[model samples]
Target: MPDQPFSLDQLRIVLIGTSHPGNIGAVARAMKNMGLADLALVAPRCEVQTSESISRASGADALLVGSSLHESLDDAVADATLVVGASARSRTLPWPMISPRQLGAALPAELSRPEARVALVFGREDAGLTNAELQRCHRHVHIPTNTEFSSLNLAAAVQVLSYECRLAWLDAGDTAPARQTAMAKGTAPAGEAPFGEAPFGVEWDNPPASHADLERYFAHLERVLVAIGFHDPERPRQLMARLRRLYLRARPDSLEISILRGILTAIEKHTGRR
Candidate 1:
């Protein structure tokens, strides 16, 4: 059969340190154009409810009015299962950066998970994201622009990424024709399945884990490691960072996260760290 329709509601567009109210409005308009409505603002320099924002938003003013504002990026992305930061600069330390197409392909599976939340983080127009801010993201997305002059306006970047996300959502839902064709060909026995094995099997014991859940796991893990003398918190040297990279790359679902947490708990009890 065909896949379920992608819900744009699962995706959140987050702006950090947005300087201009007009850009916020424009971003809202761009998101609405691509069937994305959820928006979150972090430490905005200007008021989102200003007349300028409403006027620039045109008919998409609802997005601006209903949008959420936060004091920090951490607060904004607290509940998100996946966080993707958009930037144009190269950092001293390499990050897992993916192109827009790769983001599109991976997002569909992520958003399909139970209670999944994804955040597309955008930074200021003039400076983009700071190194510290970029480090918080699981993946970084860069919109390839002209090398000679690759400065993209905040709204323009939002438009490009939003369009790509919409295309990916549509692609995920457009599997009916292929399924029909496969059935007609009789590729296998009559009762054979076509979609292949499901991730982590058919029965899931827990709802898909959120970003907050993973963070809690990491915090618990750090405590246990400290107690077990595995990680020295004072002079730590990228141990947690590397662990974050490994787990984030895997993008474990709810069941997998539970299993991992159970393993951690067992270790904690074994070492008398609990």
Candidate 2:
């Protein structure tokens, strides 16, 4: 099969509750630099298109003219196929939750699709997105940052995200093209399939896991497996592979994964396994 045709310009980045005209201008500049010109503003708290904003926009003034202004999120995302909410809080409401890097990895697939319109929604710098506002999204995201204080300025967030989008779409010329199956000559099966699907059906070798809580979950799992004789010192590695397969096959979603970890603890104590 032929590779899919991807166009980065199809992606749109939307901002909500933006408080500074200067930031709005900077965001326009950011989007332009990334080859993504579709920008939408939802109820900006500051005056837009001001001289300051235009000055910051530099040559990206065309984006300012093309940008849409709305009074609500519903209007802002009216035509979006994928909605990516940007925030530093994890527990926010939304669908398709992910981090900046996760979003970064998946954006190309979306932007590549014909007529696809992806939106990166940013909230106010003062309070970020409220739970209700985030719930409207198909997914939520948190930009990885200092745990002690995980906050980002509105314009800065736009800059970082747009930068990544630019690298994904425009950086194609900088490196050698990847040798996908279709790109290679002759008929041959790639060994990647096996590595892609471990013992179970873990489609992704390193599917997103809760890094903050995974260590503790793994420790509990190991302890229980040890008590149940599922994991023995002689062949602990083999047993772990099975457990890995189970998790992979299940493809436990973010919430389901959390529940599974909890169930593991209960099973350990109930069966006297750990």
Candidate 3:
């Protein structure tokens, strides 16, 4: 028997600082159309349940009604295991960037872990996510558009990513069963891989760290660095940002995070700063 199709229940569409109520409704519609249910709103600038929003939502009012609202992005995605932000512009500090198609291809394996919760974060209508916001994401996704008119609507962006996610889900459903059956019968080829394997065929010994876990680790790291005089908050030079990029790229698991935190504690004790 093949593995079950990835569940959209674990995938959340997060909109941050949305200024328009209609855009929120439209986003809800797009998510519902793609069979995605979890919608998180962070610091929405407009009233969530307005006539404009309901009108634009069409028949996706349920999503709007059930959406979770947060005061900050951190609270919105605190439990997510994978957080990917949609960025339209380039920054001085480049993040791990991937195309929309690549994001779709990667979802099946990412959502395979039972505890995994993936957050696809979108920014405001007028401007995108801030540098600080993008830094919090594990990866950044960009949708290539005609340079002549690259201004994609907020809801349209959500629709594009939502469609890609649906496509990946459908594709996984089509292939997973047959692959699992072959493996169960022991007729699979000598190194025949199963569906839903981790990206690049790497198997994890421990589950990936949650967003909260990474946040704690980052705080501990900065504290330890400051204690050792390696980082100076007064005259900082993007040291913490660079270090965050490095650790996020590593995608350390829970055990690794514990070990890293232990080292930080040891350093604090040695420096008598604890």
Which numbered prediction scores highest in lDDT against the true structure?
3
Model 3 Cα RMSD, 1 decimal = 2.7
Pairs that clash in candidate 2: 6-112, 95-138, 95-139
What is the number of backbone collisions in each predicted candidate, taken in the order shown? 0, 3, 0
Q: What is the alpha-carbon lDDT for the whole of candidate 2? A: 0.65
lDDT of model 2 at residue 66? 86
Off by over 4 Å in 3: 1-3, 185-203
What would the per-residue lDDT of candidate 3 be over residues 1-274, giving only the tens digit for each residue?
A: 2445679898999999999999999999999999999999999998999999999999998999999999999999999988999999999998999999989988877888777899999999988999999999999999999988999999999999999998888888888877677767766555532233443334667878899999999999998888888999998799999998998888888899999999999888888999
Better-scoring candidate (TM-score), 1 or 2: 1
- Looking at model 3, residue 181 earns an lDDT score of 71
For every candidate in turn, the CA RMSD to the true structure comes to 4.2, 12.4, 2.7
Residue pairs with backbone atoms closer than 3 Å in model 3 (clashes): none
As for TM-score, the candidate ahead, 2 or 3, is 3
Query: TM-scores of the models, in the given order?
Result: 0.83, 0.61, 0.93
Would you give me the overall lDDT of model 3?
A: 0.88
lDDT of 1 by residue, 111-204 (tens): 6554778899999877899976787788999999999999998989999999999888887678635644665775523442111123312234
TM-score of model 1 relative to the true fold? 0.83
State the number of backbone clashes in model 1: 0
How well does candidate 2 match the true structure in TM-score terms? 0.61
Clashes (candidate 2) = 3
